[model samples]
Target: MLLCGLAAVVSACGEPAPRKTGGTGTARPGDRVTAASAVPVNGGVLVDLPGNAQLLVVQPRPGEFRAFNPSCPHVGSLVNPPAGGVITCPLHGSTFDPASGAVRKGPAASGLAEVAITLSGEDLVLA
Candidate 1:
């Protein structure tokens, strides 16, 4: 009976941890960022990645998606997700274009850096 108890404990310990959902959690290349429905058309969502990186996934039009680093080019402050069709940095009042990641207003001299993502089935995957 000791062997049976030990085997049960080992199996329990070997089980994988539960995966986090929504927008916050560790993710890597080829990992699913979120469901396609989670992002709104003409707006965006912020997704957490491995190593404290952040990805901003946006949809400018139906079935059209884009991703960006979400770090403001001027000072590395995280920008808010698109609202009123604009992405804005809270620290410096910089604004960016949601569709193109272009600098719309500054303190920021450059646009946000773009990240690559692909649509896989019903999910968005880091590319």
Candidate 2:
């Protein structure tokens, strides 16, 4: 019970930390993605996700864009997003919901921590 509360605290307080200028490929958990690679400058784009992995961009419906990290929280492996709205890790086969980032499989019983990014007046505030 106590551990669950602590886990909730750790997950809820998760925000990307500032990274040094110039990064490549993917971004990590608690990492602030800039306008270089996945992140966007001119238009809205990639945002940070949990588990130290780059959140893949997904626009299921018009006017709504969702971001999810390809990595499974159970292991450090990448996860694949299904068309229906679930993310499955190729390594351990753990599944997570794209909307909530919650673990729907065993071994990774805990829910995946989701990062928040809101579009505030034409600006995507990831902080």
Candidate 3:
């Protein structure tokens, strides 16, 4: 499991990290996030948004994608990307479902916030 996480990180090092937008406004609908191919099948990638926000974009299956705020509801810590079918918070051991962002286990009483996204050709656009 640790190897998987490390592999994900190492692989991402070759891709362009999400560019930090200078605007203070929150990401709007129709904004381009990242290429769909950047998200691996049954895995995820972290994307940086304008207002210091972030999204965890996961592909639970080929041709289907889901996005989440990736913030642990317990204390607002950033959760790790899905591994072994679970999205986990490193700070407090909160676990969320990769596909639905539902709480699987938690000190958190709530689940990760879902963010809508749409695939535009090869791009994943915020929706």
Worst 10 residues of 3 by lDDT: 16-25
**lDDT of all predictions:** 0.85, 0.51, 0.85
| RMSD of candidates 1 onward, in order | 8.3, 14.4, 11.0
lDDT of candidate 3 over 14-84, digit per residue (tens): 96755342221388999988899899998999887777667899999998998888778898878888999
Candidate 3 residue 35 Cα shift, in angstroms, is: 0.3
Q: Can you give the lDDT of residue 38 in candidate 3?
A: 93
TM-score order, best first, reads: 3, 1, 2
Off by over 4 Å in 2: 1-53, 58-66, 120-125
Residue-by-residue lDDT tens digits, candidate 1, 15-115: 68554222223666789888999999999988876655668899999999999888788988889999998999999899999999999999999998887
Q: Which ten residues in a row have the lowest lDDT in candidate 2?
A: 20-29
Candidate 3, residue 42: lDDT:
86
lDDT (0-100) at residue 80 of candidate 1?
92
Q: What would the per-residue lDDT of candidate 2 be over residues 1-127, giving only the tens digit for each residue?
A: 9999999999998877754211123433334443333332222233343443355444444445445545556766655545455566678778776556678886786755555544445433343
- Clashing pairs for model 3 are none
